[model samples]
Target: MKLKHYIITSLVLAVNLSALAQSGLQKKADNLFNKFAFVNAANVYKELISKNDNADYATRQLADCYAFMRNPDEAVIYYKTVVQQANVPTEYYYKYAQALRGIKDYKESRVWLKRFKDAGGDINDSKFLKDADFINTIFNAKPQYTLKDVKFNSKYSDFAAYEKDGNVYFASSRDEGVLKTHNYGWNNEPFLDIYVKAETDTVVSTKSKIKGDINTVFHEGPLTISKDGKTLYFSRNNFNKQVLGKSNEGITNLKIYKATLIDNKWKNIEEVSFNSDDYSVSHPALSNDDSKLYFTSDMSGGLGGTDIYYVDIKNDGSYGTPQNLGNVINTNKNESFPFINNEGSFFFASDGHPGLGLLDIFGTVSDNNKIVSVINFGIPVNSSKDDFSFFMSEDGLSGYFASNRDGGVGSDDIYAYDRTPQLKIEGTITDAKTNKPIANATVTLLDSNNNQIATLQTDNNGHYEINIDRDTDYYVNTKKEDFLDKIIPVTSKGVEKSVTSINANISINPNTNKVTPITELQPIYFDFNKYDIRRDSTVELDQIVSLMKTTYPNMVIKIESHTDARGTVDYNNELSEERAKATYDYLINKGINPARITSYKGFGEQKLTNQCNGTVPCTEEQHQLNRRTQFIVIRMQ
Candidate 1:
């Protein structure tokens, strides 16, 4: 009996000790997670999950760690398990939805998004709620920018390019000639350091560490410079005077530091006043006039994750209070990397907005220091991975940004891009009546101001094509020998395609001496009892002027005007005669020869198309039909 009792006590003791070990492991994992050391924390969480100890909590934390690290492929796997359990936070639904989008599973992403909404998630803070077909809108949009890889990218993470004085400055985790002794626990890469790529005649020559006391053993870089080249600002880990500062949670947040140029070298480094040990402040950018400094931070009372804030730079060199950019420019997710162009346009990166995927760059339309709306830079500029650190030139045409997308040389790579894409207008010119191709037709392209841009002739197959600019209004004027000339208004505005097809099919009637009513024109209506032409009538009248002035120079036409029956016969006669004279004068003013107009006359309510005479009550539509002007082709040669 004693031996059996001892065996039972030993078995209980072993079980209790195993439980105690698991409890200790859980505490260590939680500490790592709180410190933003997701990589280290993830390993411990996975161990706990494998042993089925605190499986629910361990699984959730593992998924969150992956999400924070931007490893969506791993995040989705664990999130799938966490979301299925009961009493889960609604934020997990949102995180799961974003993770699914990172993998390009938009349909399933939307499902969880709706679930997130149903579970009382405040989706109103984002632009996603405004567009139900947001995914398709992004995927179907035409690419306005083209990206090319740079030569200096390394196998590790490299990004945040800033150009100054013919030298490109950027941050990289590349190991140099020295042995790698320090590695960041978050990414398992060497600590970031600022490097300069020297450019001679616009060609990159050599890259080396920046010359100064700027670089340290900890993280540094993603910098900006002043216009006069006397000052520099950059982000670094919260370390100064050979001591690292940490928050209560034991995380070393980032801070902004400024350096002054002295004897051609950067020195006198000092941290910005707004930085705190409780939160992070990084990714510095300057406004066009250098009157304000913009940055990203996770300080207290922010919208959610990191948000963009700006501080006014006084003339005395002191900073004003940091002000948030507001909800229109922020959301409940991460937003960072604020940049402003010369025209005062604000640009940043955000995962909170409706984007193709994680951390797409967005621009804002602001009025009077308030952001009114946001615009996504759409595909090719954005991808399924994280894209940030947008910097544009003063002209707003060419720029650089960083992305961690596929087919890159590094985990994050810098790409030089231009807003100009190859846009084309192409189609065939065919005969309207016969549906046959009209070879050798001349097509003229004109700008919105009617300035001639280019001229092209159709090929033997009646195919014509011309390159054009995006977001522009154009007029395509096509002419053949015996066919009617067509001035088709074509616009590239809001077009999201590489090629826009517009066929200029010409219609012709060569038979002469037959009265050809101008059926293509809109109804030319004048005001009641007025002899002058209305402004709205000019577009229709211009067609007549164009027909006589360009298409058929030898064609002759006459104008006939009429008035409604409600007016007196004598007064109507006077008004109609004056209206006919006004139309004749308009044609002559538009460069139409006076000889082309054979005659002008007025019917004065004598002819009626409908039976709405004085004896019947007529609606406005019936009365409007009576007030008309007709341009009759008396001769065509």
Candidate 2:
């Protein structure tokens, strides 16, 4: 669960047909895939395709195998093939999009994501596409803080860092005494153990594993230490009492154990009372006052795969019943890695919410148990990979987080950084034609994913301001009745020196009446040989109706339809007449007065606007220009 993977459990169904019909080689591959041995399964699957046997299944499974192993490059090649094949499942489209994004091929990834969305797939529910430009500013902007990889990371999985008592403690799978040779089936690495490094060390030349009964051969320590550093709570598999407890599925569930440091020795290890063999309960975090313990669990009654939960720690030494953190902090997807800073700010990692990728760190503060705003820790604190296990210092200036992003020293690495304030966007809104302030216009702020984040209204002077994250994309949408909507995209490129402010001015055009001979509205279009009104044409028609009814109540309007020189003159004339009648009928349906309509007429190829008449030569653009639905006001009473 800490590895953060979204796997398809239907591999049996995925390869059944091929397994029944294919050679023994494919069956071997299928067996490996079903066991979650993606690294080995991909090789076997590749061999099947190289031998030209059951290439379709091999291609898809090979792609999926690479995807499971987080090899986006290999995954993209095979996914491209599988995604184009007919009857490909919706998940393939989403995987293809993810693979593309993993390789930083964002534009191409968006194409597949759109296809996935159109096919009713979630595509991780990200907003990277909608506010790409706005989000990019955060990437391009100067950073207020900097980060560096921790010096003591090993070639194995090393992460989940915490600092206490002048020592930096972290969980790692590095080879060590008694447990050096042991490896977990999940990742082929040693089980995690807590290692400590002195704060005064310059290059991390020495790391001492915490000596206690706290670590076991199975797994231990991504832990929380109490304020006095006497009590420690850590996560471990349910292998206590030398007995391996298993869930109904025969898999081990994680549990939180409490241990106390006594006379330089950690002893009195006991599992939390609520932990059961039926579900997992781990990732313990203590509040500043030690009155509450927060953790992650998949226990019964949870809203999703896992949720954040808390228990009240009584003064006399007992825990209250666990309470789910509610919908705002928990979603139907996994939420884990709770880390509370000294200032009462809550930080956690979740995949259920919209994020840049697999998991992103989010921060929220609570006042009197009421949740405040949630903030996303933007890049490079986050990446398109699993970023979690966030720990912030007391001053809120520096922190550490674990990530599996590329170029790391191990499967997971801890990064240290100082917090930085980002950028603020300020703007004014006004009428385009009059050059006057437009007050009360709703200005909605949207993130890169097209998710609405905040809404503000322009004041009397048309001024508005909002703080935004760095290296992110956003859209400022200005909307007011009787005025054309204006959307301005703003990006906060991370700056080296802090940016004081960025300004934007928006001028929206007001809807105009048709009393003037020329109007700014676009002409409606229709398909070839089509007489029924197209859906797009109705937009302009609705605007026309609104303008006529509101501004010129008794205006007499004329509908003119035209056509290109594709067919014979008589046939073209007839087609134009049908087009004219369709336009006229639409206005009538909209409750327009019958006597206000002057006439509806068709002027076919005879009144061609370009020399393309009678096959003189014209491009599609010219032909389209000739085929138009135009409106004119004959009289206004």
The best candidate in terms of lDDT: 2
lDDT of each: 0.72, 0.73
The residue-by-residue lDDT of candidate 2 on 1-637, one tens digit each, is: 4433211000001221111123457658765664345566778888988887556667878886665444678889998998877555576676677778768898998898789789886434544444322222222223445775478888877777888877887888786556566787788888877777888766542247776787678777578899989999988889887888899899798889999999987899898888989888888999888999999999889898889999999998789999999887898998888877675557788888766678877665343455533445456666788888888777555667778888888887777875454356777898999999988788877777776655556778888765566666888888987788889888876544357467889999996632455373457887877777788888888988887788777778788899999989999999999899888899999989878888999988777778887647678888887888788777665
For candidate 1, lDDT tens digit of each residue in 1-637?
Answer: 0000000000000000010112456768765654335577789999988987567767877886676455679989998998997556566787678778767787998899899889887664364433322322222223444665588888877788877777878888886436376777666777778888877534322247777878888888578888888889899889988989999999888899999999977899999888999898898989878888998899989999888999998888888999998998889988888877666667788889877677787766444455666656555666778878877766545678888888888777778875553456777788776778888777877777776655656778887765566677888888877677788887778877534443344443332355555566455887767878888899998987777767777888778998888778999898889989988898888988898788989888997778878898889889878888887777777
**For model 2, where is the 10-residue window of minimal lDDT?**
6-15
- TM-score, each model? 0.53, 0.47
- Model 1 spans with C-alpha error above 4 angstroms: 1-142, 176-179, 201-207, 421-637
Clashing residue pair totals per candidate (backbone < 3 A):
0, 24
* Candidates' RMSD to native: 22.6, 18.3
Model 1 / residue 601 / CA error / Å:
14
At residue 458, what lDDT does model 1 achieve?
75
